[model samples]
Target: MTLEASVVHGDWEYQPVRLPRDVTRLNATAELGLRSRFGGWELARTLLYADGTRKVWLRRKLSRMREGAAV
Candidate 1:
């Protein structure tokens, strides 16, 4: 439940997504796909930990139309 700060690189914004070790592969894939399909988040990067945890970076285009609405 640790939320990290979002990063803005050029015209894209990146958010860190944590996949716990307990989640199954099928569930994870479906969930990520849902996020991409509905939230406009795309896979940017990923790091697999030794304990089977995942640290993923989801990126999307940055829009300045609203304040504090990029999360």
Candidate 2:
């Protein structure tokens, strides 16, 4: 997952920001109760904020492999 932020006025420039991968892990463990059960995540929903920002929710199963894994 990726995030992009941009200035709404003046230069109106956009920049890519880096987020910690642990966010997904934390959400899975704390919110979804999948701490020891899930191996991956999937996008569940998205919300647009009034400040032109977005929030996303994700979910995953207990036994699914990540994409492009060697079998």
Predicted candidate 2 versus true structure: per-residue lDDT over 1-71, tens digit per residue: 36554222232222233334445545534643442245244455566556554455544432224222413
In model 2, residue pairs whose N, Cα or C atoms come closer than 3 Å (at least 3 residues apart or on different chains), thus clashing, are none
Runs in model 2 deviating more than 4 A are 1-39, 63-71
TM-score of 1: 0.79
Cα RMSD (angstroms) for every candidate in the order listed: 2.8, 14.3
- State each candidate's clash count: 0, 0
Residue-pair clashes, model 1? 0
Lowest lDDT block of 10, candidate 1: 62-71
| lDDT at position 14, candidate 2 | 26
TM-score of every model versus the real structure = 0.79, 0.32
Per-residue error (Å), model 1, residue 52: 0.9
lDDT of 1 at 39: 81
